[model samples]
Target: MTNKKRLELTWIGKDKRPKLEPRILLEDVARSYHAKHLVTDNDIFDNRLIFGDNLLALKALEQEFSGKVKCVYIDPPFNTQQAFEHYDDGLEHSIWLGLIRDRIDIIRNLISEDGTLFVHIDDNELGYLIVLLDEIFGRQNRITVVSFKQGAATGHKAINPGVVSTSNFIVLYAKNKTLWKPNRVFTARNKRDTRYGQFIDNFDAPYAQWRFITLTQAFARSLNLPIRGLKKAVGDSYEALLSDFVVANAPRVVRLARPDYDAVSGDARSMIDASHKTSEILRLEREEFSDMFFVAGERILFYSDKLKLIDGKYVAGEPLTTIWDDLLSNNIHNEGGIEFPKGKKPEALIKRCFELATIDGDLVLDSFAGSGTTGAVAHKMGRRWIMVELGEHCHTHIIPRLQKVIDGEDKGGVTEATGWKGGGGFRYYRIAPSLLDKDKWGNWVISKEYNAAQLTEALCKLEGFTYAPSDTLYWQQGHSTERDFIYITTQTLGADQLHALSEDVGTERSLLVLCSAFRGNPERFTNLTVKRIPSTVLSKCEWRHDDYSLILQNLPMAQREEETLKKKKSAHPSLFDNQDA
Candidate 1:
């Protein structure tokens, strides 16, 4: 045996990856508002609307959401070498690849073992993205590439040198091939097509045909059974066998045989096996065995076991194929009340993704939540969701759109189809300030903007623990495990305080205390461990002053110029610029 060879995509800067900060989310209650029409009986405050660089947002979500999100649908900037009103769509090829690679790495970590990712893209980067996804999600894990018709061919086709683009693609991949289970999607049959019955009908209305065993020589001899409606023919040949049935004009019965079994012994077994094998070979040449059935003086037909009779009609449906053109891709501009004419995806498209990959209450994430389409669709479908965006549209477009969804005032883009008379709400969060910064003496210290609660949560995330404080135990801030707890404080700890903390922890439990300073014996307690803040966490992550627009600004100068032009034309010069300020 030989080792299997693998293929990978390589770019100029493929090896260089960004060192992202593991920041914390801070819910700004003043900016977070809910609709009055929202139902008061349910808990709808858990949905998250994060405003920050998606890379940092994804990193912040790592501790709480790793291997927990059931589905992730991202429509990143397509790098189409054009400027959009809300986003700068042009980028240097290498920079765009690196930016996507970093975010995709984190997305892979965020998805559950059985979860899947649906990445929407156009032809400009589909080939490159496929190789990139194969590297991250593995080649065998790819589910399928679905082609969606965006619109009719444009009139500019005559002037263009290439094919007129009328379709976009959504590529899907599973985190783990063995654990992923995609659900089937059923579409109603067109009334005109139903009348024709060109395909197999389901008792339900639409269905795909499946294979069934038909009469053959192997089936006839294995059970020594005779056809019920037809008399025995003189010869054992297929022509003679069918002649009896053709003359009778009645429903025929035949025995079904197990192809792999042996019933005869010695010479008789060899003779029967050879004869049956030849008959089977001849049967393989017939087309009706796989898909069709022939009836006297009638056209061929096909059906599976699922075929059913309802209301005097046979109804059937086919399995959904990779090519999807039935759903409406346009006319979704009024969805969420955000009229993003340039690149807004239809809610029906995202709805299909959710239907195929997730169930109700499962966590869904969208890093590039342009116009918040993914979030709105996920919300109406009863799934929990988190959306992150760095642009002002996070406020102007997404917030208002989601507000309308909650108030039941939005009546477009799958709202009526899903019967969404809105009820739930979402919490708005900003990425927390950096935890550590250099002081006047060039020594690292905790940022002054952090309050006590913010400090504890940031430290907990840095120390690899969940931030869940105990009500009775003030010192217990978080925990890595049931017995291993972590505590954070700015106060200095002396010998007595150390002894008391150790005693409180007891012999069975242990605590890691993080403070500004400590004065205790070197070998005093086995249940306690002390470490200084700022110094310990400084090395854990790359601390930076700005958390917003870092990923977008890091692109090449040409891309920055395009963004500047986009901002200037929109009369929003400060939109992408000075976001951190």
Candidate 2:
């Protein structure tokens, strides 16, 4: 066999990736209702609830929101071969991989450099999902795999022998590890103890409380310096220098090792030796000290002084570990008052993710907005959020739940814990239809549904330009660079029209004119590049078809069927979707 080098997870169709359309979002004002109380002077109506397929929704968000989102928490469907009430959870292994892979790729683009992504999944696909994530986010960017306890015990444990699982996994990754920094979290103080109640006169009144920490044998040995002159002054002068150094340099907590007498061999022996050396130095400094030789076995002490004091107790907040056991259960019946039968993420869980990953007013996105748990939690936590859900529950569950959150009528889940007397709102939006479709002659053309403004904006996005229309210049729809602009129109341009446009455009800048047809021949203008509209945008992305999820069966045939048939007749076979054709 020939030696291959690419280290990645491969499936049946691993090489195939979807060419997603950068669709536009259209706000549905009729369905989009917000409470008056939630609207404050600082309130921005940028919070969105998109009702459509998440894959398409992510694509729609790409151009405007690329590298803008601060956090993403998704609870995608677990391939458990189980049927869900709103969505089908079961899919073929390869098809499931393709669907998730496509969405993951887009999500990676949507997150900022310092942003984080949390994927909630079960054991059924955990191994494969981890490998896939490692490939996309890189193995180094993979933060941790947290095992969240789902419940105390399940009936399945009785039937399945020996080490049955009652937990789900949350895989966390950052877009860039060097820039990502999770917020420090503190739990409620359960006990009160003052073991290291040392006071320093050098520190100010509010910051007087401090704890003493002993230097570890490893640390002492690592220093490899004499301890003789290190402890010249004990009380005032030493405290001043150490406190100043710690405050200025060591902002985080410093850990020191406790001497272990039993394990005094190998590396521990070096620590013991360093301790004896330090004791000898102290003995020389303080000549009148009693039992100087006998005290050599004692571990050296080092003051940390960086401990936080809250309610008369020094708080060393327990850093979040890989095993998360205290999060709320997903099986809560009345959570957010939306009884989603399957895959409803607990509000507490999402709240914890936000607390660690983002601050207030940061943009948070949840493409898999099941039961709107992410939205409810994000809103109460004062985060700006955008949630997308494909199923009909977007109306039945997500909207009502969010409305309750805005009205301060929601009293369940993390409401009491977060002190949320809610006051925020999200505007509802639906992904617009594809911009381009094939006509009866099988020629690519702009869809009839697009108006002049919509067509201009769509063309700008397709050509990698920023839409910045000016009333002074009617043809100035958008611009790519400061000197390069784009103009879009549906009308066929004749010679006089082209000459007028070129004269207005001038030689100082360049312009790309996208029209239905152009009649100017022999490279007359140097600053203008005239191109046809639909033909130019046709090969840029997969158009006309919306949904990209992998489902075994179609949803219930209702009024949506007629809509589907209409789309099918207009849509042509793109490179990505030609497998069925």
Runs in model 2 with CA error above 4 Å?
A: 1-4, 38-44, 156-159, 188-317, 554-581
Candidate 1 TM-score over all chains jointly = 0.74
In model 1, the runs with Cα more than 4 Å from the true position are: 1-5, 35-44, 188-191, 194-318, 545-554, 557-581
User: In order, what lDDT does every prediction score?
Assistant: 0.75, 0.75
lDDT tens digits, residue span 280-319, model 1: 2111123444422222212233223223332123334345
Error of 1 at 127 (Å): 1.5
Q: 551, model 2: CA deviation in Å? A: 1.8
Q: In model 1, state the lDDT of residue 333.
A: 72
lDDT of 2 by residue, 27-136 (tens): 88987756676445555456999999899899888988999999999998898887888878886666777778889999999999999999999998899899999989
